[model samples]
Target: MSQPSLAPYVLKRPWLMRWAKPLSKWYFDAAAYRKLGLRSDDLIPEESEIMQRAMKRLTPKESYDRVFRMRRAFQCSLAHQLLPKEEWTKPEEDIRYLSPIIAELEAEVTERQGLEAMVINKPNTKR
Candidate 1:
């Protein structure tokens, strides 16, 4: 399971969210994946079963786009150059495409485990 995150906590408070917004933007910009034409979700490690399942759940077009971005990013990394600024992923375009699916899969796994562990009892019928 993914570790707990403070994102919800910060988001619930306007003051904390206001303070965090600029810092988060700066952090994402400094991370530089956007410069390589990749969305933040594109960087998620695919080594785990959850990620693999989430990837399989993606629409064909999204899957194709993801592969294209990864290849482009890989090429850019090898060439030691970023994509032209026009092609860089904009902040608005960096939506959480994969994360929701991953979360759904994790929830399903947890639900299945809970159901499997459930106990059943037989009613007494002696009269």
Candidate 2:
């Protein structure tokens, strides 16, 4: 057989070029900012005071849900770049697959917050 067309073959292989564009875009857009319902900075708190004020406006559960949804939307956009066009179109399926992982992360954040509160409440306790 004749020698294979190397460049064309490389592009055809999903594993080889799958992350090419998405990873590049991620590097370029490192800010993770979006302008949907509100301006990027408006939705995202820039300082401790803003975060605290926003948290006060939202109940604990509401804030958690709001944050989770925002995070998912961002994840979908990022994942779209990494996934093939066909896979990217089915965002619901992607969300289903990713939900558990997000939940685990959220739980970890909640656990860390609880630990911080405990430490603040009982400063003398090393444990």
Candidate 3:
């Protein structure tokens, strides 16, 4: 789930972001998941514990949509075909839905670990 990324570096610089945006879009388009009516987040494997927790956190509608997209993509793969152009995922529609939840879960786990490691020392009572 934690893939190495240059996103933070690019995002920190407006000029670099401007140059990368179109190239990233072009790369995404060439990757062809949109042709199968799937968002980038939809392609994330659900086998990881973090992803499983994130899936549980999704709203009913989002859960349903995720499953629908996965099944549709599977069918497309089996048939060796892409969805119709009109049904393909658009750039704006490919927002990060699950990633935010996963990040939140990761943060919570880190916070929990920090709390678990805390030590409190009481001052001397014999004053």
Candidate 4:
């Protein structure tokens, strides 16, 4: 399969984030779904380099439908697949792989809440 892209974008540029707000508000405020999407979508391209340079960075699962209600488990499974035992010896090491994606999720949530204002306004926060 082709590798995935993890390029970041503004909230307005991505129509899904904008339009999903109403439904998001109805369900966990969409923060969890958005975080799952953020992690899942970001797994591919960064996989190789991340696994090599920062092997702890676990990868999220590939397929998820937020409407299905099982998305969180899917997200966990994705991470398991992305960072299998054969690849990582320790859980902390695998957790390192998740740092970048988790950071992005936090920023996205903050932006959506209008709390911190914008991703750019906050420090780079990348780990």
Count the clashes in each prediction. Answer: 0, 0, 0, 9
Ranking by lDDT: 1, 3, 2, 4
TM-score of model 3 (CA atoms):
0.88
lDDT of 1 by residue, 39-81 (tens): 9889889999999999999999999999999999999999999
Q: Model 4: per-residue lDDT, tens digit, 1-127?
A: 2334433443446776676656545664233433333333333344454333433433333122212324444655677633333432222322223456545655665677895553665678789
- Residue 52 in model 3: lDDT: 98
Error of 4 at 34 (Å): 30
Index of the highest-TM-score prediction: 1
Candidate 4 stretches greater than 4 Å from native: 1-95, 115-127
Q: Rank the candidates by TM-score, best first.
A: 1, 3, 2, 4
What global local distance difference test value does model 3 have? 0.94
Per-candidate Cα RMSD to the true structure, in Å, reads 1.5, 17.4, 1.8, 17.4
Q: What is the clash count of model 2?
A: 0
Model 4 alpha-carbon miss at residue 104, Å:
0.4
- What local lDDT score does residue 77 receive in model 1, on the 0 to 100 scale? 96
- What lDDT, from 0 to 1, does candidate 4 have? 0.42
Off by over 4 Å in 3: 12-15
Tell me the lDDT of model 1 at 62.
99
Please report, as a residue range, the 10-residue window in candidate 1 with the lowest summed lDDT. Answer: 1-10
On TM-score, the stronger of 1 and 4 is 1
Model 3: residue 40 alpha-carbon error in angstroms: 1.1
